[model samples]
Structure formats: C-alpha cells, structure tokens
Target chain A: MNKVVLYMSMSFDGMISGHDDGPGRGLGVNGEALHAWLSDGGISPGSHRPGVGVNAEVFDEMMQTGAVITGRRTFELAGGWGGDHHDGVPVFVLTRQLPDQPAPGHARYVTELESAVAQAKEAAGDRNVLLHGGSAARALLDAGLVDELVIHLVPIILGRGRRLFDDQGHRARNLELVSATEGADVLHLRYRVVSR
Target chain B: MNKVVLYMSMSFDGMISGHDDGPGRGLGVNGEALHAWLSDGGISPGSHRPGVGVNAEVFDEMMQTGAVITGRRTFELAGGWGGDHHDGVPVFVLTRQLPDQPAPGHARYVTELESAVAQAKEAAGDRNVLLHGGSAARALLDAGLVDELVIHLVPIILGRGRRLFDDQGHRARNLELVSATEGADVLHLRYRVVSR
Candidate 1:
C-alpha cells in the first residue's frame, strides 16, 4: 500500500510560510529563511542553491516518492512545480475548478480532495504519496489519511504566518516519533500518525 | 552572568496551554496531555508523580535553577505555583499590582518586567533563572533578554490555545540548536538565543 506523507519545512513557531506568502514568493518574503537549512545543503532541486548536511539524505528519500498531492493555491503559486519535479510521476492538484488546459507531462487537476488522494495513491503503487501545501495536508489529516509526517523543524521563529496545523476543526491525533536526525540548521523529525 | 532560560511544554501546534486554561486547571482541559511526558518521567519534584526517562535528567538540571520569572496571568492562573516549585528559590510574578500579601517562600509580585528579571537574576546568583509562562517568555524575548530556550515538544496538537510565540510585534530572532534528546513521549530541544 502507498503511504501518504505530509512533508514540509516549518518554523520553530509552527508556520510553514510567512505572512506575505503568495504566487511569486511561495514561502513569502523572508519565508526562505525557513528553508535556509535546505539552501545550505543544496537539497531543493528546484532552487539549485548550495547547501550541505543531513537534508541531502532526506532529499534523496523524497525523490523516491511516486506521486505528489497539493492544493490549488500551492500548485498555482508554485507555477505548477516548474521543471524541478521528479520524472514520470503524476502530480495531483485538488481544486474546485479544473484548469482549462492541464500542464504538460504529469499534472492532473481534480475537484474533490478524496478522489484526488485516492487516484494519487493508486498511481503511487508501493511508493509514498507526498502531500504538499499546508491546506492540502490539513485536509488529509482531518480525514485521517496522512500516514506519516516529516517536519523539518527550522531554528528561526517567524512569530506569525501560516501555521501548518492552523485551526481546521480537526480532532486531536496522536503521533509516534519514528526517528530524529540533526541537520545543519534544522532538526529532521519523522513521525507516524497513530490511527484512532 | 546568570543565564535566563525560557522553559515550557508546548503542543505540536505551538500552544503552551489550551483554550480553557485558567486557575484550577492551569494547562486547560486537554493541555495536560502535553505534560504527560513529564508526568511519566516524574521529573517534576513538586508533583512526585511516577515517571521515568530522559526527562528525569532534564528535571534534575531544572531543579538546579535558582529562580523563576513569570507573568501575572500565569502566576494567578496557577494559583501561585502552590508548593510545587524549586526548593529555596524565589518565583517572581511580573504584575502591576502586588498581592496584598505575598506567598511565603515561593512568590513575589513585581510591577516591572525588566526589574523583576533583574531581581530574579540577582537572586539566582550564579545559577540560571527560568522564565515561565507564554506571555512572560514573549516579554523576555521581545526585550532580548532570553539566553536560551528549552522546548518540550509534545506529539499532540491542540488546534486552539495560547501559542507560546503569538504575534506581538517582535522581530525575528535566530536560534542555534544546541541539542535534541528523545524522552518518554516528548522531544527535549535546547536552543541558544543568538543575539545580534
């Protein structure tokens, strides 16, 4: 079975992105600070910036993910993942209205979140289904679909912004720590979602 | 110099306490779940509850702390820390109005935060001074006085509650991760406040 994993970089204050985050700047203005650890390790294939550390190992693992599920806002803001996404894997975008023409290669738009996740899981086979975007992850978590969560606990505190677990009327869920690793500028924490 | 350390148990959502947090039920209804790690380790000398783990070591270190500084709200809500406090240390309550009568051996009310911290530092001598409560920690952070932060990261997420780093017009401060240790059910993270 394909596991659904919510993986993201979050500030010490729990914000996934800064207050001014939007289209041109997906992480917001200074939001890049949250990913400075990745920048130092040059882990993000999209940016091609220089960085070195434990994130390299984590990045390599993430590259093995077979499918990506995200919300419309993240897909639109990220400009459809550009040319940095993994090869041959489908990217499912959950949105109310489908795009007139889908991007080339493997991007698909769906109206309902459940079907999008289901389709993504089927496409992923034995590999993991990566959940990107705070809203998308929250939706899956609310539905108790996220099997794992990988949080890159950044060392800075934004003090305000888009909290990864913003109040969405979701009931409390227990998490079991699977592993913890020290990175150059962040703590890589892996947790398994305990099913109720 | 007496280092001021901000110590608190926070949920995965960054909340220090839950929505219903107040006197009699200081951490809120479900907020106690956050400290279940401490409860298991029996690190709190005041409670004497049975608990075992790395928290015991952390608790021993905390017991060496010479003083504590907290906001009026936390002090009042906790009913003045009762009898569960470090031995022979003064707990300064930062408030505008001094209680008609201070609690013997444990509590003292002060009108100014800075002065209260100074007094706590002086009273602490060579030992570390602990800053407790969300508002009090925020005040110290805003004033650029906190030397370090020890966050007991609990696995549960309380969607609604008082966040430790709630927006208060404070500038972003960088923290250097010093250590990360696994405990019974919490992650003990220590970070040094990098002052610019």
Candidate 2:
C-alpha cells in the first residue's frame, strides 16, 4: 500500500528535454525557462548532483522517500552516479546490461520493469517510492505504479525537445485533482492517480 | 506607435492544431483544453461566432487594442464576419490573394507586413494593436513587430497538435517577466517585450 509519485517539470510542449540524445541540449535550454521557479527557490540545485545551494524542502522530500527508480539512459547520462543509489536512498535502475558492482550503497540494477517496481516497494518500507526519469516514469504510470503526478508546468515554450510522453497512446488515467498553484515560471499541479 | 501583442494558448508539445486542418480537432473540440478557462467562466457559448459568449474581461482587453491582425487562413476560417474590419477597428490580414470586395466598413486589403503595421498604428490613433494568428503572429514577432506577449498557459497538455511556432529558427525576443498567476486550469503570464 505504498504510493508512487511522479514529480517533474515540463514545458507547455510535452518535451522534457530540449533535444533528444543531445548533451547539454536538454530541453533546448528553453526547458530551463520552466525551472526558473525551482531555480529561484533553490530547489533544482545547478545540476542533479546533491549539495551546493540545494533547496532543503525539496531535498528533504526526495531524501525521505523510501526508494528511487530511474531509466537506464537517465542514469548513464549522469556518468558515474547513473546507478541505483544516491544520498543513502536505495536506487533501482531499469537496465539490460549486467553491472560488475553495486553502484553505491543500497543500489541495484534490474532488467524487468515490474521487478524493479516490486523491489522498490519492498525497499520503501512505510515511505512512498519516487519514480524518476522520463521513459521509465511513463512506463510506471502505464503499469499502474504511479499514485500521484506532480507536474510543475513552466512558462516558456520550447519549440522542440525530448518528448516526455511520446508513446502514451490511448492510455487514459483518471486523476483526482489535489492542488494547483503558481510558481515563479511554473504552475505546480498535483493529481492523485485513481485508475488507469 | 503601436504596441503589438501576441496571444494564443499552445499545446504541451507546442502545437497549435492536430494533424488535420479541420476545425475543433486541431485545437481540440472548440479548443476545450486550451480554452477551459474561458468556458469555466461561463463565457464560451460553444460557437465560433464573434461577440458571443466571449468573457467581458477578455473581450474588453482584446478590444482595447487599436486594431487586429491575422493570417488569411485564420480570417477565412473565421467566416465572413472576420474580414479586415470590425466595430470601427481596422483589421489587417496577411494574404497573397486580396479580397474581391471592400469588407463592409473600417477595413482594407493589404499584403505587406510593414504596411499592415502602419495601417494598424494609424487606426488605433494611440491604442495598442493585436496580432491574432499563428504564422502572421510569428512573422511579426520574428520581424520585431510584437512588443509584448500575453499568454494564458492552459492546463491541458495535448500530447500532439499543431505548433504555434513552427520548427523555423527564430531570434530571441527579450522579455521582462511581469506576472504569473493561476486561473482555473490555466496560468496567465504577462511579459513586456524588452529587446528584439
């Protein structure tokens, strides 16, 4: 009975990154326009790396979560930290390649999406699990692993970029509107996933 | 001098319409998602006719302008009432084929962008001018005709649709963020055009 939440920022366009497979081209830098609120609140911290001017509230929310899940491509792009572990949080990364060693403490890799979800649920204890990354997040949502969707809609349009939900064809997930608010350059909307 | 503003609600993927050119389908059933705010206010009469069910506030602000401009495609789609004139407001539409007859009153046909701007400025006689379509709006913005961009960032994120700004490369138009507020399922943001 654990909740899996998807929390991320997106542009008016469905793109999560400026360009696909283009380094530093993440969401066309136009995506950064959507993160102005997070940046202003110091919630996004320069890069995904923890520490440095990090927003305590946002960090605490992520840290207190039971486990973290991400896509292989997202992890790989993070270089060494792309594995299933960060800040003492047990990380479950979806991948096909077998790893030689554990990424960090409490980190592991899995080939099957369902296996990863079950593992993350076990590791979560009583805390809710957090699903990260674009593709995996969409997959998790499709598989009924997501309980809430927290989307922070940023105010700037990136004409083109990496699609966040490119393959969400014919999928319908009814959601209970939780809350909606305005952040600097973003609109924070929270929806509780009811049924898929 | 005329202060030209660009206004439109875009999709999450930055599309203005769907793959088809037919009405409703492009923006989605009478622009349901993008114009939810308008309907929520009991303003959307569910018809395309002008001066009907339009919110008094939206109509007042829009008409406060000196004149209005649109592309031939939009003007034609709007049917006869939306020619180059409306209630003493000079309307200029960008088109290769000129209208066969004079459009009622307070209207004239012109094909030049600059000429349209000049005519709009003259009509306002000290009021603002509004750009009201995709290509024509984009052209004005690209040509440094727009002075401000006031947008209602609707909440619905259509995964696919026509893009307001197509793939064509564009020059950055500096904007000074004025305000961002939450309204119904939309976020309204105002920006002053700083530099072209």
Candidate 3:
C-alpha cells in the first residue's frame, strides 16, 4: 500500500525554518544550517541539487516518491519547485486562494485538504506521496492523513522560527520509531505515525 | 573541572511534562509515558528507584551525578525530591522566596541563579552537577552557563504541556553531538553546548 510521508529538516529546538521565512528568504534567517548537511558533499551535478554522498541519501530517497504535496505558503516561497519537485511528479498544493495562472511548474492547487491528499495518493499510484512544508505536514498530521515522518534532526537550536509542531492543540500524538540513521552531523529519523 | 550538564527528557514535540503539572502531579497528564522506559524491568528494590536492567542505563548514569539544581516550580511540585535528589547530594533550589521550614529533605533555597549554580558546582567537587528541571536549564543556557545537555528523546508527543524551549528568545544556540545511544524506547542524545 502507498503511504503519505512528510520529509522535514528540523533543528534540535524544533524550528523547521528560522524566523522571517518569506518569499525571497525561503529558509528564514539562519535556517540554512538545518539543511547544511544536504550540501556536505557539495552539489550533485547530475541531479542539480545540493546533496551528495551519505548526506544525499535522504534526498535521493525523497526524490523517488511518485508525487508531492505542499502547503500554499511553502509552495509560493519555494516557487513551486520549478513545477516538478522530482521526476516531473505531480505536485498537489493545498490552498484556499488558488492562483489564476499556474506558475512555471507542475503544481495543481486545491482548496480542500482531503481532495489534495486523495488526488495526490491516486497520482502516486503504488508509490509514496511526498509531503512538504510544515504547514501542510501539521495539517495532515492533525487530520491523521500522514502515515510516516522522515525528519532530518539537525543538532542546532534555532530558538526562533516556524516550528513543525505548534498551535495544533492538546491532543497527544504517538509515533513509533521505524529507523534511525546517522548522517553528516545530522540524524535521519524515520517514524511511523501510530496515532494522531 | 566539573561541567554543568542539563538532564532532560523531552517528547518528540518538545514537551517536557504534560499539562496541569503542579503540586502533586509532577509529570502532568500522560507525562508518565516519557519515563516508562526507565521502569521497563520494574522498580529496583536495591535503590528503591523505578529503573532496572538495560532500560535503566541512563537512569544509572544520572544517579552518579554529585549534586543537582532545579527551578522553584518543579522543585515544589516534586516536593524537592525528598531533599536528596540522589545519594544525599546537595539540592539547590532557585527561588526568590525561601521557605520558612525546609521540607524534610536536603534542599537549600537560594535567591540568585549564579549562587545556586556556584554552590551546586562547588558541592559537586570533581563530579558534574546535574541541572534539573527546564526552568533552571533555560536560565543557565541563556546565561551561557550550561556546558552539556543529555536529552532522553521520547517518541510520544503530549500536545498540551510545559515545553522546555518555549518563551525563550530567538537566539540560536549551537550544540555539538557528543554521542547518540539507542535505549529501549528512547534515544539518549548527549550534546555539548557550543554557544548560547
């Protein structure tokens, strides 16, 4: 069965991106440190991405997903990942205000949450649907739509910024650790969301 | 010289204890799950502590610390750990108002943060002084006094609870991973505070 997995790079203090994360400064002020491990082996010329060697393992695995879903803010800030997140896979975006003209990429915006997830799951077929952005991840997690989490737990504590988990409510969530891998100055933790 | 190390057990969502943590309820609602790994083999009759076997590794390591420091709220809630946090080690409580009668334990109340820390460190001799509770840890960390962090990363997320990292300003703190050990159901992560 296919799964809906969230891939997020978070600092030890739980910030997904530093404060002041907007259109131009996507990762916020000092949030680049969270993703520094990705560029440890320098840019991969073949993939044209900032990840190689052991550091790129997670990125490589993320690229293999059949489809991707993102929240509007992240989609706009990241410029829709130039249409295709990976391998021209369908990018399903959740947003209330849909753009009139689609940006340069392969993103399809939807208003409702379930619709976006359902379409993304269908588009993914037998492969997993890559969940992107903290907003979308939180929403999916709160709604119990996400199946797994692939968190690149960075060692730094960015005391400010957008958190992957916040303002959700007082509902306790349970996650089972599936795997833990050591990366270059990072820990790649995979967890199965058991309860929401 | 002995270092000031913070020993904290935090949930995956960064909660230290659940909501309604006061007076009698120290761990708060559903917060006991975080410490469940410590008693996997049930309570140890030898030490009269709730930790035994392989799961008690961190607990055993924690028990060896010479002295301890804790915040006023947590200190009062835990009843000052019956005055002996461990082996009759001096327990320093940071509070503005000193109690008229000390609780039947070995706790000494101090008004200032530095005094408590200094006394605890000096009392510890060559052994490390354990920084107990999130409030004291935050104050010490903000003042650049904390040297190391030993976090027992629990897998569950209690959505409503007291967070160790909340309310602190947006100053990014850097930590170098000293070691990462896999426990029964918890990940024992030790990090050296490089910058506050």
**TM-score of predicted structure 1:** 0.93
Clash list (residue pairs), candidate 3: A83-A105, A83-A106, B83-B105, B83-B106
Q: Which tens-of-lDDT digit does each residue in A116-195 have in candidate 2?
A: 88888898989878877788877787777788777766544465666566634524444555766554445656677766
Cα-based RMSD of candidate 1: 2.3
Residue B50 miss distance in model 2 (angstroms): 14
lDDT of each: 0.82, 0.64, 0.83
User: Candidate 3 residues A1-196, lDDT tens each?
Assistant: 8999999999998899888788898687779898888777566554534455556778878888999999988887877777877889999888878789764577888888898889999988999999989889888887889999999999898888888888567467788888888888888888998986
TM-score sort, best first: 3, 1, 2
TM-score of chain A of each: 0.90, 0.80, 0.92
Interface root-mean-square deviation of model 2 in angstroms is 4.6
Ranked by TM-score, the better of candidates 2 and 3 is 3
Query: What's each prediction's clash count?
Result: 9, 16, 4
**Which ten contiguous residues of candidate 1 chain A have the minimum total lDDT?**
A43-52
DockQ of 3: 0.71
Q: Write the per-residue lDDT of candidate 1 for residues B99-164, one digit (tens) a residue.
A: 788654578778887898889999999999988888888888888889999998988867788889
Q: Global CA lDDT of candidate 1, please?
A: 0.82
Best first by lDDT, ranked: 3, 1, 2
